[model samples]
Target: MSTKNKRGWIFLFALPCVILFCIVYAIPFIMVMATSFCNYTLTQSPTFLGLDNFKTIFADPDFRVSIINTLKWVVIQSTLHVLMGFIMALILRRKPKGWKFARVAYVIPNIIPTAATAVMYSLLLNPTFGVVKMLYEKLGIDTMQVVNLFGNSKYAFWTVTATWVFYSGFNMLIFLGEMGAISPEIYEAAQVDGATAGQADRYITIPMMKNAFGTCVILASVAMVSQFDIIYMTTRGGPGNSTLNLPMYLYKIITLENNYGKANAVGVIQIILGLVLVILIQRLFNQKKEIEEV
Candidate 1:
């Protein structure tokens, strides 16, 4: 085909995607922005309030607590998840005996529905008649006051975070795929140069897997920020809102309190936060890439 004709055909082909983007993403985003400014309960006609929702959400103590909790989750959960995933990926990279079976077992958690996992964990962590309680009792640890995982605020948050860390096998799979794609010749050369496995991993594998690491970081961060199903089904932001992440808090406002506008405001804040996080992660990755190239 002629160059001009090819360009015209490409533009025609891209038109559908552009239209779909508008329909799927742009339209709903605009509507959400609009809803954030209105006082609507979804039953009543929305009345323009002009930032009142945002103001209320900012002033609400519960919302503030939710934001703090979400920040904690984003920082702690994402870091732990990525770190554990990286470690698991590294360990699984080598073709050990039964490696395939181990990989399948690791990813089984990710395959299970979050709600089901949460329910299972809830039972396991239950203060009464739970395996955890029974184990602690068997170990001569007091089951009455010490074995309450969900009852205590400090333990509850950590318990929720722990559940996510081990379930990060999906992230491990991503990193493993990326690591596998690296040219085997590079590792061989490093070995020839008297590099140890640890040294090669430190200098070669990690640096080469920057893109995958960046993707994992972004995914984990977003998942932490928007997590609802497991946290809701497990803790329900219990122990007096101590575990109330942003999404669960927003759910309460919209559903329990019938505060749709305020909930939309929270959603807007979440989107803005997510955008900032993604931009920061991308910039960090770009800087690392430049440094590596140099």
Candidate 2:
């Protein structure tokens, strides 16, 4: 085909996707951004409020707490969650006995619905008839016997963290896929150079998986930023906003408070925050990759 004809066909094929994206994502984003600057609710049309919503959000103590909590979860998800997955991938790579079964078992939690996982954790940590209370009694740990993990301010944050942090199966699968693509010759050469298993992994395997790690970290962090279902299903951002994050706070503005203006303002902040994090992570990874290449 002539170049001009080929270009026409390419445009024709891509047009549908472009139109769909504008309808589904672009238009909604623009609407949300515009609505963020207005006072909007279900019963009334949006009134231009100029930055009042943003101002209110900044002055709200709950918003501050939510921002802090969201940032904390982001850090934990990016570092500890990704690390857990990486460690599991490394262990499975050795292909010890029952490795296949272990891999499948680890993935079960990830495959389950998030709401279901939250419910299971809620029951397990109910502080009354929960399995955790039973275990504590069996172990003679009286101090923890009366603790309501999802209710108390001091323990709710960590309790919510526990429900999701160790469920790193999705991140593990990403790392495992990256590991599988590595050439066997590299390890064989390392063996020939008298490198021990640890040395080979440290000097070769870990370094090679840097890109995958970066990708996983970004995914995990963004997921944490918008995490809501589990916290809502379990703690409901209480007892007294203890486990409140951005999405949970946003949910309150929309549902409980019936304020779309403030909700969209929070949404805009979330979008910007996520973008900033992604850019920073990309730059960090790129800089490291360049240094390694050099």
Candidate 3:
């Protein structure tokens, strides 16, 4: 086929997907951007406000708290969550006893719906009739004197943090897939050279998984920024907004306060924040070389 004909055929095949993407994603994004600068709500047409929504978001103390809380969750997700998955992958790399079963068990947390998880954790960590207090009491700690984990300001943030940070099953699956692609020859060579298992992993396995780690870091961090269901189910940004994050705060602006423009402004901020994090993570992981080559 002539190059021109091939190009035409390719465009014809791609047109449906292109149109669908524009309709589903691009159009909503454009609407959000347009409405964010105006005062809008369900009952009224958008009125041009020219940055007023953004200004209100910044001026609100609760929004500032949400930003700080969301940033904290992002850092923890990108680092600790990714690390947990990496560690699990390394553990399974050695093919320990029943590693396949262990992998399945680990993924149960991620597979459970966030609403169910919220409920489970709430019941498990309740001040009374909760395993946490029972365990604390058994350990000779006075649970009767302790506050409910999700109710107290001091512990609520950490409690909510715990819910997602350790559920690294998604990361584990990604890391495992990346690790599986590695050549066995490298491990074999290390073994022939009298390298211990730890040395082989440190020098070969970990170094080679850098790209996968970078990808997981971006996925986990962005998930944190957009997280809402679990928090809404558990704390509802209560106990003085201790567990509040960007998405939860955004939802409140629309549902409770009925500020559509402010919600869209928050959405714009989320998109920009996500883009910045993606770029920074890619640079940090040295994925730019791969991108450039592509």
Whole-model lDDT per candidate: 0.86, 0.93, 0.91
Model 2, CA-based lDDT: 0.93
Worst 10 residues of 3 by lDDT: 141-150
lDDT for 162 in candidate 1 is: 73
Q: TM-score of predicted model 1?
A: 0.89
Superposition TM-score, candidate 2 onto the true structure: 0.94
For each of the candidates, the C-alpha root-mean-square deviation to the true structure, in angstroms, is 2.9, 2.5, 2.0
Over 223-247, each residue of candidate 1 has an lDDT whose tens digit, in order, gives: 8788999888888898888898789
User: How do the predictions measure up, each by TM-score?
Assistant: 0.89, 0.94, 0.93
CA shift at 200, candidate 2, in angstroms? 0.5
> lDDT by residue for model 3 over 231-275, one digit each (tens)?
998999978888888998999899997989889999999889888
Task: Report the lDDT of model 3 for residue 243.
Answer: 88
Error of 1 at 223 (Å): 0.7
The digit string of per-residue lDDT tens for model 2 on 1-294 reads 899999999999999999999999999999999999999999989999999999999999999999999999999999999999999999999999999999999989999999999999999878888987788888888845478889989999999999999999999999999999999999999999999999999999999997898899899989988899999999999989899999999999998889998999999999999999988998878945666789
Which of 1 and 2 is the better model by lDDT? 2
